[model samples]
Target: MTCSEKMGSFYSGITCQDIPPHVMKKARLTLFDFLCVLRLGAKYTVINPIIKRYLVSLEHPEKYTVLGLKMKSSLEHAVLGMSVVSHGVELDDGHLSSATHPAVAVIPAALAMAEKCHSNLRDLLVSIVVGYDCMIRFAKAINPKHLSLGFHSTSTCGTLGAACAAGWLLGLDSEQLSHALGIAALQSAGLQEMLHENASIKPFQVGKSSSAGIIAAELAALGSKSPSKVFEGQYGWFNAMSNNDYRETDLWDRLGKHWMIMDTYVKLYPSCRYAHAAIDSALELYDEGYRMSNVKNVKLYLFQQGINEVGVFKVPSQYEDALFSVAYSIAIAFQYGKVRIEEIASNLQNTRILEFADNIDIISDKQMTDSFPREAGSRIIFEDDNGNIVVRENKRARADFDTPLTDEEYLLKAAQILENVVHRKYIDVLWEKVVLSDQKMDVKEIIELMNEMGA
Candidate 1:
């Protein structure tokens, strides 16, 4: 069978009962994290251009709620806003295996489609699982090469994934769902060139992808036809997007059997997942008495993926560059004891952080390749005046499935992200009303609650 057929059948087969409780919890946090980032990102200047370009001049239909803005928006515009915000902060949930920001691409699209269909919490969770599974699995089928080929996996794979969720919500049959996937695949657009140039297009691509999913589904339902063999055709996404040396792996290997959200990694720090392992090691060292005071130079023996993405920028000059800069992320960790959006934004001219970041080295090593995606493993070396004060190697990030964040931690994180933007009472209400429970949710009501609770 064709890849599209396989995935369409898979999406058609999954029921709310097919998903486990733990996966449900993971899906809830995935949704919650998207909301948190949306709350925090609403204030960013980066978000202004998008809002003005879309919401200011164009009229909104007042069908859905944007996280912070009081203006009611259509489902497409709402998803667009959510996608922009979720990816804007760099705090979105990631699928390690696919190297794609899963939640930013999937959750927003799911929310928009769910809102449109008035889908319950159970089906919403199930749709998210299908969407995430489709995206991450397709990404895995054409990864490091997909990165190497200059395509951002989040946008490319997310298009198809979002289509699955949207198609499911819109009640599209397998054939229509296949067409939706095809049309969504046709809309796949993202380039890593922005990473090198410090452009905002990366997040914009995610926003576009999120909206495109529903559009594809709507068009498909209206009898739009596309290449059914969009995935494994002679010029399929994998080979067309990646290097010619591509083999289409089982993108739908376990589909309904194992959910993808269960394997997602939550960002403990608001930076690239690539820097998480090294940052964790640095923090652990500080905890073990290797404080940031006497550090001279730091070395990170990183997986190929990490080295490829964040290795070049020793010092970032613009807003986007700093977000992707390995040195900038690690510097903020050691110097400020955390990686905050303000630190990266306001400290662009901080010489001390720049010099320290310049002292850091990210070397690509093959030993960590096997553990890559599944684990963002790193080996770190710290040099101080005392000479080689610490050496940390062979460690993966803590947010892996084994050491997942607790409910208390997620609530605290939610409170922290919302502390400055939304009131504490609303944050608590949101946690109790939406995230903590597994009941049918009126997304519009939650949005109203947040709007009422905004500081």
Candidate 2:
């Protein structure tokens, strides 16, 4: 069978029994991380407004609870709302190979479909796992070139992942699932131009991709038919968008044996993943008592890929710019002792921060540049007023799956977000159930608990 056929067959054949205990544990952690990030986005000015606007436009409200918001929206609207919130802070889980935010795309779609279909807890979790797996696998299949070719992977690959998850939730077999993917592929579109212009449309890509995936799955359920070979056919996704030689076998090489959800990196900082290593290096220096005032010059060495990704902002004047700006992130870390979600909102143009950012120089270090994608590393050199120099290097940040945050640390992060949206007592109670529940609880129950807390 062709790659697309094999993938379709694999998705159709896989069952909960196929998932190992360790993989399921990782999936649960991912779900927790997703909820935490979504809550954090609830407090973001940009995210709340978009969610409010979308919620206000819902034609017929459903029973699904929009996270953090006390309102109910249509399934489509709910998916859109949740997606915006998930991506609002840009802190969602990301697949390094595809460079797509899988949770942002998959979780929203899964939640919306679960509410509408009245799926149980097991169903909800499986759908999320399936969605993340499909999205990341497709993204890995179309690697660096798809992202480099000016298509936003989060939107493009996310759409396909959303479709797969939605299809699974709706119980579509291989044939119908294939059609859903094809339909979603046609609707999948997000330009990297938003990055070039530094616009707010970047986060919207997640919502759009997720909503489109739901639409595709619904169409397929209604007996729609589309091309099955959406990935590796002669004029398929890879060839059309990537403009590179296509390999169909890469799509299903180790399908069930390797779970992509485990490969995702959870963000410690709320900024871009490309900037994490630089932030790590800066934070290390600070923890070692490196003061900002004493530093005369700050130099950063990163991989060529890092330079291409986070090195865009020469002089960022705004919060969004700062998120994408390695120079700005490094400077903020040096000046403020750390970078937080709040730091992105605080005026970035503060003279001290700007002055430090201006003194920041970023260059591609050949040694680090050669090992990129395999490893994200950075080196920071600080020169003191007395001409003393301190250098710190970090190969990767702590939030990666390889070096995951402790349970307490993860819950603390979650609590910080939950405290902002709901009451502190609710955070403690809900966290108790979430962390220690023997049997999985329904997602709706979780939402209901939050609603009660708000009430």
Candidate 3:
């Protein structure tokens, strides 16, 4: 069988009953995280309002509701808008192995499709599991190389994931799902160049992939044919995208037995995943009584990839720059001993953060570079005016599977995002509905609950 066929056959057969209880639990957690980030992004981020207004101006058929907003639009546009909003703040769930954000890409497409089809909660959960599997497997198979080649796998591999979820919701069989994957492969696109340019439209690229995935699945359901060997053909995705630098084992190893959603992570900070380890390490130094006023110089050591990405931004003027800047995050961690949305937003004009950011130097360490994609480690050196230095290093960030957040931690995070934006009652109800309840529920109920919120 071709790559897409094998993946489709395995994933299309995964019903809610077949999914293990643990995997379902992880799916709920990620779903809750997605909704929380979606709300925060819509209300807090500047880009979401502009995108919503543009979509509203288009005046497409108001068949679907955009979460955290009072507007409704067509299915594709609604998913597009919501996907952008979900990733707007960079606090959405991500996978280290693939170096991609799956929930932001997959959940919005799946949720919109589920609402359009009135799918049951069980099926929605199953689709989410399979979607994460497809997206992470494809990216893990081809990346570090795929990512090094300047492609944004969240939009590239994420298109296939979104297609599978939407196709499953539409009741597509294995064959149709394979066709959808093939169609999505042709539509997959995004770049890492935006990071260099400091563009805020990075989230828009993610949203376009979600929209493309939905279109691909709809076309496949209508009998549109596509190449079955879309992943392995001579001119297929692997060769064309990964330059043939990929691992076959990463694609199919323990496919049905090991769920990729279990390997995913939820973020506590609204910054690039690469910068989290450094922030954590810096916070540790702060705990040891190293205030910004006492520190004379700072040095941060990170993987070459991390340095290549986050280390580029020394000073941040806007949201995108601040989210991707390791120096700014470290400065925030030292200056405030915390990095939250309000802290980051309010400190952009603070001369202290800017000065501390300027004094911090980022270095690429070979040891850290080799440990990447498994553990995003960092080492920090702080030197005081008296010539005394303190160093701290973290092998990994705090929110990985080994150091997973507690149920209470997840709830606290959700409450922080939903506070003052939605009623406290709605937040509790959403938590119960998504993470606690298993009763027969239509996806539209979730949509209606979210519609009560607005930016």
Candidate 1 Cα outliers beyond 4 Å, as residue runs: 60-62, 243-249, 369-371, 453-455
Which prediction has the highest lDDT against the true structure? 3
lDDT of 2 by residue, 268-358 (tens): 7777787898898887777777667777677889987787767887567666666677887877787677677777668565877777777
Candidate 1 clashing pairs, residues 3+ apart or interchain: none
Candidate 3 TM-score over all chains jointly: 0.97
Better of 2 and 3 by TM-score: 3
lDDT for predicted candidate 1 compared with the true structure: 0.76
Write out the backbone clash pairs for model 3: none
lDDT tens digits by residue: candidate 3, 160-201: 999999998898999889899999999989999988875588
User: Which lDDT value does model 2 have at 410?
Assistant: 74
Find the 10 residues in a row with the least total lDDT in model 2. Answer: 431-440
- Model 2 stretches with alpha carbons more than 4 Å out: 45-47, 61-63, 246-249, 416-423, 452-455
Give lDDT tens digits, candidate 1, residues 123-205: 77778888888888888888767877888889888888888888888888888888888888888988877777756667888
